[model samples]
Target: MSKISKLFKGVSGSSSSSKSKHRARGGPSPHEAIHKLRDTEDMLTKKQDYLEKRIEQEVAIAKKHGTRNKRAALQALKRKKRLEQQLTQIDGTLSTIEFQRESLENSHTNSEVVRNMGYASQAMKKVHESMDLNKIDDLMDDINEQKDVAREINDAISRPQGDDFDEDELLAELEELEQEQMDDSMKSMGGLPSVPSGRLPSASTSYRATTKRREDEDDMRMLASWAT
Candidate 1:
């Protein structure tokens, strides 16, 4: 008996040492824990199915033995009750394991979110390290000044050259030119000869007629005096 006890103790010690060694290598991560929980749940589910089948079979037997064999029916019902109890226990265990798994998963997600937020905060801090309100304002002012200068340059470049003439002087010169043109046109019209529209004699013909008439008159007068 002592030897048997020693053997059992040796077996237990070896199992414990193996577990400690495994833990030393790397304890079960959350992911592994979740996987283990899922496997356990699946095993429990199969067990529950088996229990349900056994319960059904017991019920069928109890029905078959009805009043003819009361003892057999009683025994079958008892076995069914025990299986139901085991099924209940397994259901409770599965519920606990599932709740733990879900809680761990939620914790992991929250931790990741927190870690990422911390990283983001650091990045924002780094980005802001080189910046200040005053510097930004100065930059903006410089940009505005440059824009103003550029606009002035563009205006100067785009302006028409030789556009310094006075408006009033230009208008006066234009009026003088118009007047000279009018005067020239009038003089040209006056130099043109007028045409006779009716049967009036021309200037040369009228002059010649007048001269002959005067000569005739003088000759007639001389003859009258000689006669007197």
Candidate 2:
């Protein structure tokens, strides 16, 4: 075959070889990427083990609370199991990507091929997925601790309620809280001049308005007395 014909045939073969996964993402051969991904998975396993221990501790605390809503611990376990299953799938995909790398064309476009071979590797995807798992684990731990504190407070409240639940003081507190909230809302409204749906101004604003009204009433009385 002529050199031109041979070159044409090779180009045709290269084009035929290029597929969806081979779209270039950047550096890193498929083998190197898989190795790095394996390392990441190993690190996650250790982290998962530590989180697992903390989860057990939370479970024990929930039991002491009289009502064990182990939702956080249970969800953590579920997410850990999900990571395990994903790790297995990642392991299985490694060989397929390696094969694709070996079969890649000798042309200078191996980077593109490497990039696409990476796409099908579940290990690469799992590393990204692990980020979300870690975030969720933190959220679960926070919510669990918060709930545990709330439960402890509730248990205390149930005990022979002898502390003179000062009704007047409580009412005053509610009024103060309502007033502060009203001031905050008014300030917010003052910034944007828009009427709220069904809410009214807080107690502080009402008190101020009442004071102005009383002053007006006194001034009217003085005027009436003077005129009479």
TM-score of 2: 0.21
Provide the lowest-lDDT 10-residue window in model 1.
188-197
* Position 44, candidate 1: lDDT: 96
lDDT of each model, Cα atoms only? 0.93, 0.70
Query: Ten residues in a row with the worst lDDT in model 2?
Result: 99-108
TM-score of each: 0.55, 0.21
Q: Model 1, range 1-228, lDDT digits (tens) per residue? A: 699999999999997996897689787777777887899899999999999999999999999999999999999999999999999999899999989999989988898899999999999999999799899999999999999999999999999998798999999999999999997998888855666789988899999999999999999999999999
lDDT of 2 by residue, 77-173 (tens): 5665665666566555655544554454333267777777888686778878767877889999999999999999999888885677979999999
Candidate 1 deviant stretches above 4 angstroms? 1-18, 130-135, 146-228
Best by TM-score: 1
Q: Any runs in candidate 2 off by more than 4 Å, and if so which?
A: 1-26, 67-228
The Cα error of candidate 2 at residue 99, in Å, is: 14
